[model samples]
Each structure stands twice: as structure tokens, then as C-alpha cells.
Target chain A: MISFQKFRIYINKCFIALICLFSFVVLLPFLMLIARLVKSGLKYICLDFFTQTSPSPVDAMLANLAGEAIPGGILNGICGSLYMLTIALVLTVPLGILTGIYLYENRGKKFANLIQYLNAVCYGMPSIIIGIVVYVSVVKSFHSYSVLAGGIALSISMLPKIIRTTRETLKLLPAYLKESGLALGGSYTGVILKIIMPAAKGGLLTGILISVSRALGETVPLIVTALGCSMINWNINAPASSMTLLIWDFFNTPNMVSMVWATSAFLFSIIICLNLIAKRIGRQWKFILYHE
Target chain B: MNKNHILELKSVSISYSPGSYALKNISVSIKPNAITSIIGASGSGKSALLRSINRMHELYPNIRMQGEILLGGKNIMEMNPVEVRRRIGLVFQQPNPFPTMNIYQNVLSGYKLNKIYLSKSEKDRIVEECLRNVSLWDEVKNGLNKNPLSLTVGQQQRLCIARTLALQPEFLLMDEPTSTVDMFCTNRIEELIYRLKNNHTILIVTHNLAQASRISDYALYLEKGELIEYDKSNIIFVAPNDKRTEKYITEQVE
Candidate 1:
């Protein structure tokens, strides 16, 4: 008969080896995608890529038929994305943080419980469904696909993320911190704003950054609301373009493959830079608050 | 109610839920300008009794308190809890100086929380006076702007004391303030308590019977949820009173 202990040890080793092999298999395609994008994307990047507006797809098609080069840049998309993302962030951050604070302070209350359940349901809702909802509510009401509608849609998608993260972070704080504040004669609002909020600053900022990043790359909501413009537009009531929209639209065209790759690279860099800045700020705040 | 008593608890009973009591019908009067220590085993309601003085127990949604707690002849139950807490400061068991605040800010936190603005010079004077009262001035004088976490556990506890004192409260409630520190810090804190009794009415809850005898002017012994005995500290420590008190004291020593 086989020894039971020996069989158990062999099974554990086999499981470990299998996990390692699967992890490497998962990592290989991701590394290749990044490498391919960087190699092709580097050559198309130029100062003009960030300085001029994108040409219309019809204009590019006609130029291709006439044996002429398609001429334009992604500046309109970059500008539009930044403007819409800023509006969405402003709309969502304050409301989301306030909701999170209420949930934490009035924990186990009926209204707070209802809100928590609703937030969880909203977080799990698909981005496309949210886009369609915003289309009917804001886009149809305004009688135009506009930047404002797009921003509102993005805000809805990001709100649940910010609220959940803020609540979870605040919940991790020790109970004694609040008690200490009360013992110092602080009112409830005073303790929350001065002590608890400041203590959770790094986590709150991280949540905001994560929400911004997610909103920046979102495509489906902007498609249904903003409807993609080729010209640089400053009016919030007018249709606008974004990097993700540019990539989605241009990739399907026969001659605009290079444009799509370049926009992808630009989008990748923005996300990387944003995350790096967030991590650095978190480290600095932690060092100042705790290590010193 | 005697005018000499700064705090009086009359038939006070606390329960977290129906049909159960954490502190049952406890009554005691604390004299002004004296240190009173409440000594009991764990789960004997020492901390609960102390929290009732500053209305800290009301923070919980399920807690129920009956009867009256009078502060200087005024019923604390009828008073605003924020105002009552301002007049009666508390120090917790663990050293919890606001981790985000510097020493100066931590000391001035009471003023800031109450929205009581002060001139820069006034703030400076208050910080110095409060820190000195806890005997932490010389050690932390050079690093006044440093984070409170940079200090040792002992110093952090002292800083918390200074933070409480900055409110200029009439009574100071300390719940096992030295239980988490070293013996040397314990001795120093005990000495500070002794000195502070000259100006402020102090109520402390401690599990250490020896500590109660060492620093308190009066001693209260609690068993389960009942007040078994209370008298002058020297008499309670030296003379025999209740059999439970004697047994507990001897058991601690042995």
C-alpha cells in the first residue's frame, strides 16, 4: 500500500508547480501586448500628435482614394478627454465622499443600509447599461449628444468605486481615534472633519485616483453620450471626442491603424503617470504622518 | 448634594440591552481637589462608571443609563454632552495621540475642536503650560513640531494627558492611563496624578490595587457590578473592611 503522508507531500508539490506554470502562461500574453504596442507606437509619436485636431474619417477615406496622405493629430481627443474627465471627477468626488462618510457614521441604520445595498448593486451594473440609461435621461432630454451628458454618465460609473473605497478605508481606522476626539470635547462633525478625515487622507486620494483612471479609459459611455467629434470643441453642450473613442473608431478603418496605436500609447502613459504620482504622494504623506 | 463634592452618582445603573446591567445601582461622590481610584477586576464596570461621567457611554446606540449623575450640583444627563465633556476630560487606556498631528497641534486640538480661536501667543503659552504640567516639556521641548508617534509610548500617554489638560476641564477622568506603559513611565504618571490632584478633581480606574493605594486619596473597590467598599486609601489598604477586599488585595500580592 502507498504511504498516505508521502502521497500528500507529492500532491502539494504538484499543485505548487501547476500554479506557477499557469501564472507564467497568463503573464506571457500581457508582456507581448505591451512590447508590441511600444514598438509600433513609438515611431508615430511626434509633437504634432498632441498639437493638432484629428481629421474626419470621411476626409481620411477620400484622401486615401485620391492617393494623398491623411493629415491630422489627436489633440482634439486629448483635450476633450481631459475636460470631460475633470467635470466627471468634480461631480462625483464630493458627493461620493459625503455619502461614504454618512454610511460610516450612521452604520447599521436603515437608511445607511439601504444606501449600501444600492451602491453594491450599482457597482455591479455593466458600463454599457449605464451608458444607455444616461443616453435616455440626459442625451434625449437635451436633444443632443453633448460633453455634459458624457460626463454625467462617467460620474455614475465612478461614484460607486469612490464611495466603496472611502467607506472601507475609514472603517479600518481604530475606534479609539474617534473616542479620543470626543474626549477632547470635539463635536461629532468636528472629529470627523479634523481627525478622522485627515487620518484617512492617503486612502481617500488613492480612491479618487483609481476612479479617475477608470473614467479616463471608459469608451462605451462616451460613445452613447458624446458621439465623437473630429474638431476641437470647447463648449460643454457640444459633442466631444476622447482617446478611447479615437482608438475604437480608428482601429476599424483600413488606413488609420497607426493613429490608433499612437493614441493607445498616449493613453497608456497618462494612466502610468497618474498612478506613479498617486503612489509618491501616498508615500510622502505616510512618511510625514507616521515615520517622522 | 454637598458643595465639596465635584461629582455625585446617585443610583446610577447602566445596561447595554434589556434585562442585563453592566453597572448596577452604583453610587459614589467624588470630592474636589482629590484623586479617587476605582479598583476592580476585568468586567467589573470600572471603566463603564468612569465613562458615564463624561457621557462617553452615550456614544453607543444600544446603551441605556438610568438615574442621575450630578456634576457640581447640576444634573449631567440634562446638560449638553459636548459641554459636559468639555468640563470633564478623559484619558484612555491606550496612548492615542492624534497620529496625524504634531505635538503642538495635539495640545491645541481641544481648542481647535471647540472652534475657539486663539492668538498665536496665547496658543504658544497654552502649549507650554499643558506640556509642562505632564512633565513632558523638557523631553519634547526641542521637538515641539515633531509627530506624536515619534515619541515613546510613555511620552505619548503623557502627551494625551497634556491634550486633556489643555481643555481646562474641572475634572479629569483617566481610565487605566498607565496600564499600557512601562514601570518607569507608570511611576512618573502616578507622580503627575499626585501633583495634579492639588488643582483638579481626578477620577481614575485601574486594575492595579497597589497603584490605587499609591496615588489615590480615596479608594473604591468594586466586585462584579456592585460597589463593595469605598473609604480613604490608607485605611482601605491598611485596615480590614470587607472580606472580598481583603481577599482580593492578598491575592494580588501573592
Candidate 2:
């Protein structure tokens, strides 16, 4: 009995210590990276860092930019990112939600299975490959690089992820939620739009935010299709640049390297803001889960 | 053949697939203004029978049902499934008040979905009366804008009942509606079932024999998907004609 107890204790210790060791090992790199990045990345961050663009190779200390800082702000890059995320979100959210609904509502159909297979394939397809497809289809058709082109490409990558996440979330919802909606005389469209949408709002928003952030960082697809531009441009019909391309651009220009750090800082701030907004929305959506 | 029969099932049988029948050949009548209870063990097709009244079986493409279920003398299977569903409201065992909507919006969900336009004040009156009928008005009156999820489990179940009541259905089908709820909510639902008997026909599927006895005028005892005995609640409870019913009651008592 004593040996049995010792054996059991040994097993318990092995399991608990194994988990702790694995987690610590996994966290080590992240801890080192954040520490290094913050220590090095903080020096290049300041008011001018955000305000000024690189007018010259030598004047990239951010003071020059702060000196010129005005309404322009990160205005152009901000506009580009917003336009990209908005277009991607607008197009992808509806299509993603509908695709999810189709997958669940008609899971038995051959067409549904085919679509699901396509969705899975697209999900695993590298972002660069998607960009290649979109480049040939959208940008090549238009014969120019535009925010619209980048959005179209990014949406391809975003669509499958958003759809899969949303469908999985909706699947987690109690089956009775949909049945209750139907029982209350809701139509097919009504059950999805009013009932499922509300119940899955938090998860849906999380999916969108994750997709948006993922799309925001997407460099390879944007590089081939939309490339990058310097000036502030709005009309999606016009050529534009985004933060990811900007990051890639600065990294190659060793003299313009500090601008990359500043940009990283800026991207981090926006993502933090996005996560905060998502959390607030998540709190709002806890209502649906509570009643479930 | 009764003209007043709100819903009738004639030799209705529902099958899971070709060879497997969930509900065997059964025929029953539901009155327009009375409480009818279906009491059976789990998987006895009691819920299946209730679902068939509204043709909700169509939601499951694999399941096939035979025979005819007439809703107000009209064959529901022949009618538009959507239309049939609208007129026959149902509540399930779980409290499923729409999580996205507030109490008022939950109540108005039926009308909103069907695109039945109602004025603001008129909507208020309907909401008030429905909540009051379910004994949830005073508790929720002040928090009309509060999300339905904020309510306790009992309140949420009551909210679902209110959502069903708002449709003004001719018949309401509740499938084990109280099985998942606490006794306080169960009592409230039972009382609502009794009260609703004066306005609309109600069908309930329950495992609680005492509950079925208290609120139901008639009881149908089903076993292994077969309707074995259906009679006045007192007769079914006290002097069950079928051996299965007797066995079930005795087992519950023990």
C-alpha cells in the first residue's frame, strides 16, 4: 500500500510538474522577446515618432516628424488600415455568417460539404497564395493596385477564419436557442439575424477582431497585390499603403529602422484598443450565454 | 369528427428512418380550450408527437411522419410549414428567451419576425398583458430594457412563455417545459397552463405524473413510442387500464 501510494504520488508529481515545465518553456521565448522588444523598441517611440514621416534618412529620430505633426497624424496609414479592415469586415462578416449558417442549416447537402471542404482548404492556404489568387483575379482585372485590391485579397484570407470561428461559436450555443426562436414564430432569416446573431455576438465580434488584426498584419498578400504607397489616399479606388507594408518598407531601409519600431508601437496600441473594445462587447454579450 | 377539436392526429406515426419508428400509429384529439398532457418515459416519442402538431418535424430532414394531423380541420402537412408553425406556438424544457433581446424585444420577437406591424403603445399593452398572465409582469415591469439573460432561470422560462404568448397562438405545445426548471418556476408554468386553458388549447409532455394529474384534464400514457392508454387524468392516475402505466406509476412511487 505504501509503495502504491508512492507510485501514485510519483505519477501525480510527474503530471503536474510536466504541465508546469511545458508552460514555462513555452513562455520563455515570449518573455525574452517582449523584454528585448520593449527595451530596444521604447527608445525610438515618442510624439514625433507618430507625427512625422521619414523626410530624410538622417532625420528619422522622430523629432522632425513631431515638429511637422499636425492634422495629417498617422492619418493616411490609419485611413488605409481602417479602410482595409472596414471593407474586409463588411464583406467578410456577412459572407462568413451566411456561410456558417449554410454549413449548419444544410450540413447534409453535397454542396454544403463541398463548400466546407473549400473553406478548409482556403483556411490552410498560405496568405501569400490567397494574395496570388486575388492578384490574378481582382488587381489584374482592374490593372492597378488599390486599397480595394488589398481588401479583396485580405478578405480571402479573413473569410475562412471568420466563418469557421463563427460557425464553431454558433454551434456551441444551445440547440434550444434556435428552436425557441422558431417556436416563437421566427422565420429562417429572423432566427439567424435576431436570435443567433445576438446569442453569438461576443464570439462573432471576437472572430471579426481577430480576423481584422490578422488582416492588418498581412504583408505578403498586400505586397504582391496592393504593394505600398507613401502618401495619404482614401478612395479605395485609388492606390494606397497600409501599416504592414509600411513595416516591411522600414525594415529594408536600415537607416529608416526606428520608424519601424514606432510603427510597431503604433500597431500594438491599435490592437490593444481593438481587444479592449472586444472585451466590452464581450461583456455585453454575456447576457445571451447567461440565459442559456 | 368533432368540430371543436383544435388539433387532431389520425393514425399518426413518426419514424426515425425507414424501419425505425419513434412514434407508432396513434390517433388523438386536442380540445380548443383545455389542457392535454402526454406523460411518458424518455424517448417515448411524446415530444415527437407534440412537435408534429406544428409540423416542426420538417426541421429534421431525416425523420418521416405518416398519416394526417389536422389543425383546425385543415391538414397541417398540406399547409405551408411556416404558416402552421406560426399558428402553433411551442416552449421547450430549457428557458430559451432570446439572449440578444431585452425583455420587451423578446416578447415582441414573434411579431417582429412575421413583420406584423404594431404601434408602440399597442405593443406595450400586449407585452404587459402577456407578462402579467405569466405572473412575471411586476418583477420585470421596471426593467423592460434589461436583457432577458439578466433574469433568473425561472424568469427566463417565463420570458419564453411570454414570447410564445405574444404570438397569440390558437394552441401552445410545451415539451417537458418544466423538467429543467426549479419547482418555483414549475409551479408558475403549471399555473400558466391552467390559466391558458380558458383562452387556448395547451399540450404538455411531462415526466411528473403529479403535475400531469393536477393540471391536465386528459392524459396520454405512451411507452416505447406506443400510445398505450389515454384517459381522464384521474382515471389514468388512479385506475390505469394499461399495465405499463401502472408499472411506471409504481416505479415512480417507489
Candidate 3:
């Protein structure tokens, strides 16, 4: 007969094996997706893939017939993405942080709780719905599918997440820090600006980066709002083309299918890099805030 | 009578909710340049009484304070709370030295918070003087640029004390400032508190009865928000006039 200790050890080992198998199953799809993207997309990522504006469908079809590479890059898409992203960030970050601060300071108040509830509802909303709403409001009012409309849609989508992150980060901080600053005869604004904001700087930065990546990944919203320009457009009020929009456009054209994979690969790399940086900042800040 | 007391509370009652009082009609006088310890069981309003002096309770909503607190012959309630807080500094139970700040910056945080700009030389002098007063200057003098969180908790608490002292407040209110530190650190902090008595009036809420007996010139014992006993520490510890105070003192010692 086996002893109880041996039985327990056997059971623990079996449990560990089971957990490892399940975790591997959970990660399999993501690993396969990355592998597929890298395999199909790596060869297309050349210098012109970045420097030149995306080729017209006819140009791409002729290049394929002649056994030549695509003539142009997703330059217009890159420029448009950057332009809309800047506007979205400018609109989202400050407003979200301020709203979060108000919620934190007015904790347990009826009005604050109502706002929190509404923010939760907004956070749970579908991105496509937000895109359509912006189309009806901003796009229709301006009579143009412009970068501004696309930016407004993306900002709306990003706001709730940023506010949640800011409030949660502030909440993780010890209450004593605030009291100590106030005790030093610091006014509320002074303490928040000078003390609390500095301490929470790391978490706040991580929040911004993660939100920017999320905004970058949003495709459906931009399709309905920005309406996809064929050329590089600098005006905020003009039609714009984003990376996701270009990917969508490439997928619809038969000869430009390879361009879709390359764009996906670029977007994936950026998002992954951003998430890794955010994770690093989160860890380093936790160590500094809690550990010696 | 008013001339003898540096700070006076006249029937000051605090209630968290509408009807019930957390601190009930507390009337007491604090002598100048002395260390007074507030002692009681948990939830007996020792903290509420200590916080009332600095108006710290106002930070939370739905808490009401009735009655007046007199500081230097003027009503503190009538003063701007910011001004009142400047005159009365607070130290918390935990040693929080502003995680983002270095030792030098932590010491001068009060000035920075108030936006009171100081020349580099003047700022350096204040940091050195405050650190020296806390007996931490020699140890941390070389690492003034180091983060305060890198120090032991005892050193962090001292840095907090130094930060409060940098403001030169009239009274220092400590809410069990040494509770989180070890015995040796507690002794060091007690000694510092005793030394600080020459410059500022202090009101500390302590769970340690022995610590109160050892350092306090005056002791106030409370039970369920009522001030049960107030006298010289020698009297309160040795020959208390109230049975509850005696019971609390005996119970805590065991």
C-alpha cells in the first residue's frame, strides 16, 4: 500500500500537469495567429512598403501579372492613423484623468456613483455602435467624413477605459499619502498636482499607451467615420485613411491581398511593443510604490 | 484658566452620522511645549479627538463637528482650514515618505506643496536642519538623493516627522506614529517625541500604555467616545481617580 504522502504528491503532480495542458490550449490560438502573420507577411516588408503610398488596385494587378512587387506603401494610411490618433489622445487623456480624479475625490457620493455607472455602460458598449453614432453626429453635421470624426469616435471608445485605469491606479495608492500632503498644509489642488500626480505618473503613462494601442487596433469605427482617402490628406476636416481601413481596402481587392498581411504584421508588432512597455512600467512602478 | 492652556476644546462633539457621536462633548486643555498622549481602546475615539484638533475629519463627507477649538486665544473653526492645518501638522500611523521623492525632496515637500519657493542654498539648509533634528542627518546625509522608500520603515517615519517639522507648525498631531515600527524604532521615536516637546505641543494617540506612561507629560483616557480621565501621566498611571481608567490601564498592561 502507498503512504498518504506519496498519494498526495502524485495528486499534486497530476494537477500541475493538467493545469499546464489547459494553459497551453488557451495560448495555442494566439501563437498560431502570430506565426501565420509572420510567415505570410515577412517577405513583403521592404523599404518601399513604408515609404510609398499604397498602390491603386489596377497598379497592384498589373504588378502581380508581371511578377513584380507592389509598387507603393501604406504611407497615406500611416499618416492618417497618426493624425487621428493625435487628436484622439489629445481629447481623451486629460478629460478622462480629470473625470477619474473627480470620481476618486467624490467617492460614495450619489452623483459620482451615477457617473461611474454610466461610465461602465459606456465601457461595455460595442465599438461599431460608437462608430455609427459618430457618423450620425459629427460626420453628418460637418457634411464630410473627416479625420476629426474618426478621432471623435476613437476618443469616445478610449475614454471609458482610460478613466477606469486612472481611478483604479489612484485607488491602489494608500490613503495616507493624500492625508499626509494635506496635513503639510497643502491645498487640495497643490497636493494632487505636486504629490499624487507624481506618484501615480507611472500607472497613468501605462494607461495612455495601452489606450493608444487599443485605438490603433479599432477598424470598424474608422470605416464608418473616416471613409478612407485614396491619397495622403493632412487636413483634419478631410477624408482620412487609417492602417485598419487600408487593410480592409486591401482585403476587398483581389491582387492586393498580400498587402493585408503586411499591414496586419506592422500593426501587430506596434501593439505588442506597446503592451510590453506598459507591462514593464506597471511592474517597475509596483516595486517602487510598495517595495524598498 | 485660558492663559494656562495653549489649546482648548469647548464641548467639541463629533458625529459621523446625523445622531450618534464618535467623540462626545470633549473639553480639554493642552499645555504648551509638552507631549500629551491620548489612550483608549480601539474605536474609543482616541483618533477622532486627535484628528479634531487639526480639522482632519473634514476630508470625509457627512461628518459634523460641533463646538469650538481655541488655538492661541483664537477659534480655529473660524480660521481657514488650510491655515489651521498649517498651524497644526499631522503624522500618520504608517511611514509614508512620498514614494516618488528622494530624502532631500521629502524633507522640503511641505515648502514645495505650499509653492513657497526657496533658493537652493536655503532649501539645503532646511533639509539639513530638519534631518539633524530627527537624528537622521548623519545616516542619510550621503544619500539625500536616494528614495526615502529605500530606508527602513523607522527611518521613513523619521523622515515624515522631519517633513512635518520643516513647516514649523505650532502643534504636531501624531496618530500612533510608531505603531508600525519595531520596539527599538519605537524607543527611538519616543525619544524624538520627548525631545520635540521643547519646541512644539504634541498630541499623540497611542495603543501602547507603557509608551504613554514613559513619554507623556499629560494623559487623556477615553471609553466609547467619552473622556473618562485626564491628568498628569504619573497620576493616571499610578493613582487614577476613575475606575474605567484604572481598568483600562490594568487591562492594557497585561
Worst-scoring 10-residue span by lDDT in model 1 chain B: B1-10
With candidate 1 superimposed using the best TM-score fit, by how many Å does residue A2's alpha carbon deviate from the native? 14
Candidate 2 C-alpha lDDT tens digits along B1-254: 33644688899999988989999999987766888899888899998999988877878888999999988788988887667778898988778776667899989989988889999999999999999999999999999999877888888888888888888888889988888878888898899889998888888998888898899999899889999998888898899998889999889867
**Cand. 3 Cα-lDDT:** 0.92
Mind giving the per-residue lDDT tens digits that candidate 1 earns over B141-246? Answer: 9999999988999999999999999998989999999999999999999999999987789999998888988999899988888998889999778784999988
Q: Candidate 1 residues A38-57, lDDT tens each?
A: 99886778887889898777
Q: Please tell me which predicted candidate would have the highest TM-score against the true structure.
A: 3
Cα RMSD, each candidate? 2.5, 3.6, 2.2
lDDT-better candidate, 1 vs 3:
3
User: Which stretches in model 3 have alpha-carbon errors above 4 Å?
Assistant: A1-15, B1-5
Clashes of each: 0, 2, 1
Selected candidate, larger DockQ, 1 vs 3: 3
DockQ for candidate 1 = 0.74
What would the per-residue lDDT of candidate 2 be over residues A99-166, giving only the tens digit for each residue?
98788777769999999899999898988888888889888888888888888888888999988987
Give a tens-digit lDDT track for model 3, residues B1-254.
33523899999999999888999998998878889999999999999888889888898777899988998778988888888888898999988899888999999999999889999999999999999999999999999999888999999999999999999988999999999999998989999999999888999999998899999999999899999989999999999999999998888888
Candidate 2 chain B: minimum summed lDDT over ten consecutive residues — where?
B1-10
Report, for candidate 3, the interface RMSD: 0.9
Interface RMSD of each: 1.5, 1.8, 0.9
Model 3 error, position A217 (Å): 0.9
TM-score of each: 0.94, 0.88, 0.95
Per-candidate DockQ versus the true complex?
Answer: 0.74, 0.62, 0.77
